[model samples]
Target chain A: MTLDLDTARRLIAGTRSAAHERGLKPLTVVVLDAGGHVVAAEREDGSSAKRFEIAHGKAYGAVSMGLGSRALMDRAEQQPYFIAAVTSAVGGSLVPVPGGVLVRDGDGTLLGAVGVTGDTSDNDEAAAVAGIGAAGLTAQPAA
Target chain B: MTLDLDTARRLIAGTRSAAHERGLKPLTVVVLDAGGHVVAAEREDGSSAKRFEIAHGKAYGAVSMGLGSRALMDRAEQQPYFIAAVTSAVGGSLVPVPGGVLVRDGDGTLLGAVGVTGDTSDNDEAAAVAGIGAAGLTAQPAA
Candidate 1:
């Protein structure tokens, strides 16, 4: 199923609120649909310029691999060369970071993924999880 | 000003409608903020897999150069070696095509750009112009 625009917007808003509540640095949030295409994205004022590209790379990696970026990070650690090859093949859009989370519907159908950047990786992951939850979706890491 | 999600969605919808009216091939549309960050994008069913990337490249080239892709195409034709070098420097994310158009506000402030693919260059440019107009924005080519 496709990731609806409303949910994507809600995810962005939720992520922003989560970051604000924690007093984290400005963030860039990106949501990619099931086809690994951008649905919505936002870069908060004062965010580092690279945050948007980082967020997009994380989301692209998650959707393209059908796994959360954390899972990719773990796999990359063991297979560095493989990840490097894949990154180069995809024009360097894969980011094996902790902040990319896969979104699933109630039936466990893949909806998309949300990627957050501009803070610690752990904090970014936490905000992404909260945002997915706020959008009434489950955040599932790859098994 | 940045390209907001609402305006991006409207642009996509407008482009889709234009394509349908003209019986063009399925299209992929991408919008980038003034900072050259993707704001939103959509790839219609039946569009080629690379359409999204092509659309994004067109939009990125437009916003990054502060000119429509048609203008870039003209320049590239006159300065092929320089354009090639610049495209290589940017990692091949620049598409100097007619489909990329700059978005501007009423007072002529650049907001972002819209790129359309999956049709003839002229048709794609027409759809992009229609999309920008539908969003209540101006589509300005470089002087």
Candidate 2:
């Protein structure tokens, strides 16, 4: 099923609340539908200008690749040139980062992805996981 | 004064409904906030693959220039070389087409922009205007 607007907004709210509770920096969160299109996005006050783009890139990359961005990051580490080529192929929209997490339903069906930016990669990932959990969804991050 | 998520979704739905009523082709619509960031976007089934990007480019260009895409199209016609240079400088994100319309609040404050792509440029413009009106907002196209 498609990730509806209400779910996407809830995901963003959850991510923002988790970021606040953890004392992370202002964050930008983006949710992309299964078709790799933006469903909803929000940039918290004090977030940098590029945070939205970065967050969107991460979510788009995850949905396009059908894997969490952490997996892409791991692959990029081993094959930087390949990842660069992929980036060029996609017109520079791919972001191999840790903050992108895949969203799945209870039956393991892919819904979409959530990407966060503005803090350390690990912290961003944590917030994403917490947000997905708070929304009662599954976050499938790369091992 | 912001384009909240609910407003953005309403604009998209209104655009889709207008397109359907007019018997236009499948369309992709995008709404950008005042900061030129995507608030919501959707590509209808059977729409072309690049419709989302084109719609987003049109909306972003409108918000960035604080005018409608029709105005940008006029400017491009008068100064093709300068417009080309600007397009190149922005990595080709600006679409000087007729489908982008500026959205304004009742108080005449700029809220954001909506872009629609699928049918002819004129039809797209009509759909964008109809969508904004249905959402109880003003669409400020060039005079």
Candidate 3:
């Protein structure tokens, strides 16, 4: 399945709806193309604008590295220098957080990703995961 | 125009080059997915720790709204409530600042955006814009 703009948009809308239904706080939901590009992004009102972009970075970084942003965050915690160096090496394209996941189709085909932010990392992750579920997509665990 | 991870990375690298070439302080750069979600982000060494997130927000907000952060900032000045409403509308996905630009392709599609911080708003905007240009993508002005 291609993570085209239409699909990406649907994912984001679903994410937003879940957040709204759950009375979740403002959230930043980002959609990426299979190539790890932006397809659709939206931030619930009153959520941190930064979350919108940061979530994207985390998701994109995860997609690019095939790992979750939290893993990077963990690495950053233990090896600040290495993480910092890599951060420097990549010119700031990598951020570690739990706000990212790969978007997959029914058969596990890579569709793209939906990243969410604006709450605790766990909540953010839940929101994104829920959103993906809403869209009939699966979220790849950050391995 | 699509904003792929590769292009986003190149844009970020170029922004850093420009900053370093000018001996600017470490900065933060953020790349959002096409859905105005974050795809990649980095905080330069010596830059504010929060810069990473803030810059990401600025860019994410810009992409989500399909407008420049600066314009959003201006709107925030007089219509704080309106800006606030936007934040609520998208779950806090709107940030009005001067450091974000829309990422587009030659065909003018909304791919995503980049935001930078750790310098003056002008400087941040410059870096983000430069990053987009370096990636061979168009950074469109706010409509």
| Tens digit per residue, CA lDDT, model 1, B1-143 | 37666787788889888889989987878888898876666667667656778998888888878889999999988998877887877765888888999999999999899988989988999999987888889997543
lDDT of 2: 0.84
**What pairs collide in candidate 1?**
none
**Model 3 stretches astray by more than 4 angstroms:** A1-143
Q: For this target, which candidate reaches the highest DockQ against the unseen true structure? A: 1
RMSD after Cα superposition, model 3: 10.6
**Candidate 3: residue B129 Cα off by (Å):** 1.4
True contacts kept of each: 0.20, 0.18, 0.00
Q: How far is each candidate from the true structure, as Cα RMSD in Å?
A: 3.9, 4.2, 10.6
Candidate 3's clash total is 35
Residue A50, model 2: lDDT of 64
Q: Which ranges in model 2 have alpha carbons more than 4 Å from their true place?
A: A1-48, A63-66, A74-90, A103-113, A118-139
lDDT of 1 by residue, A20-135 (tens): 99999888898888877766677776676567789988888898889899999998999989778888887658899799899999999998899999999989989999888888
- The 10 consecutive residues of candidate 3 chain A with the worst lDDT sum are A86-95
Question: Positional deviation of B131 in candidate 3, in angstroms?
Answer: 1.9
What's the CA error at residue A17 for candidate 2, in Å?
Answer: 9.5
Model 1's CAPRI class?
A: acceptable
